[model samples]
Target: MHRDLHAVTFDCWGTLIYEPKREQGALARREIFRKCLQQHGVEVTEERASDALREVWLRHWREWQAGISSDATDMAGWGLEAFGIHERAAVERLGCELAEASLEQEVRALDGARETLEQLARREIRRALICDTGYSPGRVVRQLLQREGLLEFLEVLIFSNEAGVPKPNPRIFQAALDPLGVGPEQALHVGDLRRSDIAGAHGMGMRSVRIRWQNDDTSDLPDAHAVVDSHAQLRELLHLDGS
Candidate 1:
């Protein structure tokens, strides 16, 4: 049924990259932000900085659900707002700094990630990346993809922070289509989430593939054109070897 497929778009988190749970990752990020503020001569308590970040994320979560998107530049400014520094220039600079530092943290690509992408490229299938960022900025995510050598394999990239609205919103999905010059019917979308990836693509008339890793549970979700666990299974299903 996907005879007309000309493009493939992927969800980043839980799909291309595996993020380990670091009990102290947020704490570490907060410390980095705190230090950056100190270097700028603005002092903020660690506890206050952490709380501000949590609050901003919670607010952004609600906003993202309502179809609003934001970026780390804003978070960097908002986080420093806890210390009463309202200069836009200073806040934006600090946000960039925070994101750059956070990129040095650990983020591992999923098994078969590089191999699968390389094969996709070898076969000349156009690919894109769409993701909603968490504590780390989209800037950090892009750098991670580059670090993992996955950046070159993608043709389009859209992150929630940069998109200003999260998935399930058709705008960002449309953005993915722009570079490829493909309509929804000419593309397939692969992602782990029902609401964001699958549903968003479905809503736009794009074929959707639901992907699940070993630890993912998506049994209760609506149907997809294909359900796959690993890149090998996906390659088999798509017959990417040119069979």
Candidate 2:
């Protein structure tokens, strides 16, 4: 066992997986909402639904900037409520449906994602995921991991939606330490976003690695223990000489 580190925490979207065809995924969600509204006898144009979704996203963006996080399902409900729909169960179901639509190839595991996870498993190191989810809720994100065979190695799942606070906030990252039975010094965090992942883990006293993936612009980068381009580098950095 690597005595210097007890656990590895990762960010979900950009770090471990890439959700391609983002436009198509957005369209799938919009269509779901469009149909849902039609069923509720409030038929509207696609642009109208898009407007409502955009507004809701803005609200969440503000909350996130303030170090507050809310679930995608909750945001979905709020967006629907703005259009005069009040069925709580129905709203939640629709919200989930929107997220479910993105679980295909459009949302796929990033390169080296599997290799890194397997190496971690082989080494018997604890693993966890911390993400700020707004477009996809925790349930759907978990399903994506399950589908790709990555969920088994992860011992903990922390989402801003469920955590009630997003990244750059020490509270959210602090929540993972207790479950993993590891202190800040014993944990390493890997993520793509400098503002959230690196800063949040650093704030909580964990060594942080920022993965600079393709098309991921990283200028004026935040301070982290290291900056890597791929999961392979991360494994190497942690001294996991690939078998």
Clashing pairs in 2: none
Top candidate on TM-score is 2
Pairs that collide, model 1: 69-164, 69-165
Model 1 TM-score on a 0 to 1 scale: 0.84
Native-to-model Cα distance after best TM-score fit, residue 157 in candidate 1, in Å: 2.1
- Badly placed stretches (over 4 Å) of model 1 are 36-48, 134-139, 214-223, 241-243
Candidate 2 per-residue lDDT, tens place, 1-243, comes to 144888899999888877677778777777888898888898889999888878888998888888877765777788889988889887888877876777743677888888888888788788899988877778888989888778888889998878888897887788877799999989999888888888888888888888887546465757677878887787788878657
Indicate the residue-level lDDT of 63 in model 1: 68
Determine which window of 10 residues in candidate 1 has minimal summed lDDT.
Answer: 214-223
TM-score per candidate: 0.84, 0.89
In order, candidate lDDTs are: 0.79, 0.82
lDDT of 1: 0.79
Q: What is the lDDT of residue 72 in candidate 1?
A: 69
Error of 2 at 183 (Å): 1.0
Error of 2 at 82 (Å): 3.0
